[model samples]
Target: MKKLPLIMMGLLIFSLVPYVESASVGKASIDQVMLSLGESVTFGDYKIQFADIDQAWTQALIKVYAKDGSLVTSKVLPTGYSLSVPDNDNPLFYVRLAWILRSNQKILISLESELELVEGDVQINKNDAYNLPYKFNDVVIPAIKVKVTNTYENKANVRIVLPYETITATIFEGDHYAVPYKLTSDFQYFPYLYLYLKNATTSYAVFDVYLPKYPTTVFQLGEGGAGGTTPSAPGAEPTELVYNDIMYEGENLIIDINGTEYALGLNTVGYYSSFTLFDKDNNPLKSFEVKKGTGYELSEAPLVVELINYESEYKRAYLRVYAPRGTEVAPIVRDPKIEVSVSTSSTELLLNDELLVFINVENSGRGRADNVNVVASIPTGFELGSEIGTWSLDTLNPFTEMPVLVYLLKPTQVGKYELGPVVVKYYDERGIEREVDSGNPLSITVYAIPKLSVTGEAFNGTWGTYVHTQEKT
Candidate 1:
């Protein structure tokens, strides 16, 4: 029994000896070696290579220091002269084993052949090449990576709104134009990356890429532009034209609304005799005429304004007003749809830090605005601090206009921005969710003014002021 056990132990040792020797010697002798970082490099006539299945090989050791060392990897190859090194840092190696001579099939026994370690510290050169005195124990590779980020808003889907009746005239010349328009406070647009490359202490190049241009439309609906037009009332008495109460100095009968001030076409000196004078009480008074000492009288008092009829093609709207019957006011039509017209007192502004967005809500349709919910939806990346009160309009107040204000945060980047389908989703007269009207889309363009800084002294020369190339000692 003891002899049988000893014989079994010897058999096991004999079975492992050949496998261990295979690392130092193979069926054939190595003729050439080509180490690749992540793939196998082809050697002349034969292809001896190995690859990492689960791990990467960062360093490799070849048996021969210059051309004599021979080292084999964990895997064996039938006929090849190459090895594949991975791109990550992991200790792995491969050895080439081929016949240097083909005449005789004499297998050479490479005894205890191990890859030689580097003698001194390795150094890398700028030419992307290396001058190593000794061979590496394992192949080393650098990790490559790719990354991308989205910095632009959806441009093609953005909607831009213009003020009502505001004509945005753009003359395209040479395939480009600089157009100007007002932007709503809730505007949010795409942002692009600006790359700059500099060599040493000098700038080399700058790259400006317009991410993408989004689709946009004019004004929130029923305000101005292609929509919002209607015919004037036939035989309708002229409503008192109450200009904003803002007045300018120097006895000028002009009133400033918003930011613009306008004057009556004629002087207001005693023109009220032919003109009719009426008070809010609908009572007529002769003293209301523009006397020699009296300047222009107040055109009209606070009146409820509403959009009665809207004509899209003419871009006009008819308004019904309950005015005092005593004023001899000439009803001048300013609208293109009718002889009467309207001039807006609104101005476009680029607010970088803060802005006040105003939304006016009214019911133009014949249906009563019961439970009318006007929702102002802003774009992403914008913040609404708090919900200001509703337009304080009574359901009983017929033909009423209510104003809602929203404060907008300034944008960091410059571009065209858009906010909402100002949705006016409310139940119609039948208590059904039947209305699908949208407030006008608004557009705002954020811009940046670049600043240039000059350093050091100057010298006047022909080359547009010679600059010092180097620092003074």
Candidate 2:
């Protein structure tokens, strides 16, 4: 039995040794390494070589090779420019040229391996510990551990345990704490761990943590070209407008330009896709065929319609409509739908009587309403008595209602009068100013008091008035 226990222990130790040896220690990184022409330096599986330099010394050709001595990539890197190995999107490493010295025929460059960043959200109970795993290329390495020690009132106390030291921090909701840690055996410390407390309760807490597998180095290059002006590099594309929604077949996209509403409709027949422009009354103005991923400008208007993609089975077309020639074109999208209501304390009142008017506004859409201005029309027979004619609000969030706007109005002349259709002007989330009316007007009736007068003559039909003790009949 004793020999059997020892054999099992030996087998367990043998199983863990290969896994420890197979784990990667750290990422390869070098900075400001000077290499002469045809000279190469090896970093892990990739080798960087200074292949050739142009006669003007403005550009140099660099080549990268894999460990099997096979060429991987060749790029002519300009001074002060960088080349990402493999490609820019999923770059394994980066090669940045610092400067070219004609005097010594040498090029200064730097190589840095991409750091692997891992981020996730963890929900932990109070006094429970969560181990944060550091991964490099999907292989787990040594990392720190975090424990939620205490949580009170919207704040959480956490303890971070590293291989060398431990740290404690008190963080509120939406607060983040960054701790320096070493991912490898090397002493280089990096702010490799980030803890963000998203929400915390008395019994439990939710937080997000960000961990990087390796440390990084930032290099500052000197000014290049004449007068410290860097020439524009090639392969930079201009930014194009992106479309968010996919329009279905037979759908209309309405655009408003300088008080005119132009409707653009898309319809596909067989293999052909056509966009038709129509007036506000649905009268067709012009129609043109647009290919996929191509832009077609309307001859009737100064607008361009780009077809991003088309799905025949789903009858959907992804399109982007804009003004290509710098013409101002505003597309009519879903905005903050604001509805207003106006009410009064009493519909009928006497002359000089004040009427209490209440105006309420609500946003029923997903967009926000900004710079809202409410203008109550003062009728011909009434005048404002208390508040100003216009009321302003800085912002009204979506699905929210503003406080009732109250104003007093006194009837100037006694007659049947119409009170309101309060005009509301505001800017939507797109900064486009829009106007809306209450639509329902309040009808009010003001009555004037009757006057009674009597006169008596003392001289009996002589139209002369005499007082004292004598009574006139």
Candidate 3:
């Protein structure tokens, strides 16, 4: 038989359902309860004490009563009382032993003196028979103590409050009426701890410890470095790093990765350090190793970079560099010197032809300069005169002067003419070329060429006796 097509084969598949039922369910489990009653406790004395009547015979005699002024035992009249028959049988106690007792059950112990009758005789006297109900005084208990367990040394005033019936719980700290407890028991004997006394008859109670008022610390973070972290030396010495007897002043700890210190009273888990180191001086210091166990011995002040003095002028005009006062690093002489030149000549000569005019050119200040040149402007109808000696431009240090020489050239024009807009351009120590030109055009007054002629003279000429006049126009 020919094979069916793939699509046809898939369409022809047949399946049977399995006879089965799948089952699944989610489950959960509870962990042990770990309730910490914080760190404070308050308990009052004369708090209601419990007696297991069913468990212990001759238990602390207890009297039970109802709140509605019903008839209950007036006082916890203890067993072993004498009967009417002198030394007869022992007084029978309706209560049994091993019975769990409760405080709020309106129970009063029989041993208390408040239950005593005023009349000693069996006959009721007029004054003692109709007497009012008895009143009982309250009990007072001592404060509880709590000691915290931690790895570091720390001093703290722990607080705790006690619970009471007539009054709400109260707060207490070190020397502040705090209560104490032992971890060995769950306080079954005394369910409530007294916190404070509201009045003569009421008391406040609690079971937790408090640490509300603790010291606060402030610090900066990161790479630019931080404030100082020098710790004061151990013991009783004063240091810039450590401040004692100051409120909230902790040892300025410089902690590296995983560094540790033992605190005074409490144990503290170490926090990972932020890489910021404190800069003792505002100045930058060279790289050095900072050991973890050993505290850094920082300079009390910041590093300083100063400019001593500048010496070179030409190769460089401004001379200023920085150097650390007492460190190995040298100071930098950024852009120090400035070069300048002034030309005291005009571009156009305003003088008569061949007139000689004296001009002065100078560098004027302290700066290196070179490539000096000078030229004189000649007006129309002027001619070149003798050349002056060449100006020497060997070198011009700071505050030095250089001169150039140029003889006058005749002016060709009668109007204003420029002698020299003397252009002085030179390279600074940085090898950067700079130029400066200075000149106001010079004005010249040219007079017309003078004419010399003979006016008259008696002369013997070929034309005899006539005044000899040779007039050539």
Candidate closer to the true structure by TM-score (higher is better), 1 or 2: 2
TM-score of 2: 0.33
Number of clashes in every candidate structure?
Answer: 51, 0, 87
Q: In candidate 1, what are the lDDT values of residues 377-406, reduced to their tens digit?
A: 655544564545453222412234444434
CA deviation > 4 Å runs, candidate 2 = 1-45, 48-62, 98-119, 134-136, 149-159, 162-172, 175-191, 212-473
The sequence of per-residue lDDT tens digits that candidate 2 reaches over residues 1-473 is: 01123443353343221100113222344444556777776544567787777666666677888769899876666554556675555666667664564544667665645334355468888999998655555545555688999986467899999777899998777666777554233223344566778888898888776543333322222222121122134111111122335666676777655456778887773245787899989999998887654456565865656565676765767666643222233443446889999989999999967899999988987567999988888888887788732376667766687768888888888899888799999999889999999996888999997798877444434443444334543
Candidate 1 stretches greater than 4 Å from native: 1-352, 391-397, 436-440, 455-457, 460-473
Ranking by lDDT: 2, 1, 3
Model 3 agreement with the true structure over 200-306: per-residue lDDT tens digits: 21121212222101000111111222111212232211121121111111112221111222111101112211112233332323322322111222232221111
- Top-lDDT structure, candidate number: 2
Per-model TM values vs. the true structure = 0.23, 0.33, 0.24
Best by TM-score: 2
After superposing all C-alphas onto the true structure, candidate 1 shows an RMSD in angstroms of: 40.4
Query: Candidate 1: what lDDT?
Result: 0.28
Note the Cα lDDT for every prediction shown: 0.28, 0.64, 0.26
Q: Mind sharing the TM-score for model 3?
A: 0.24
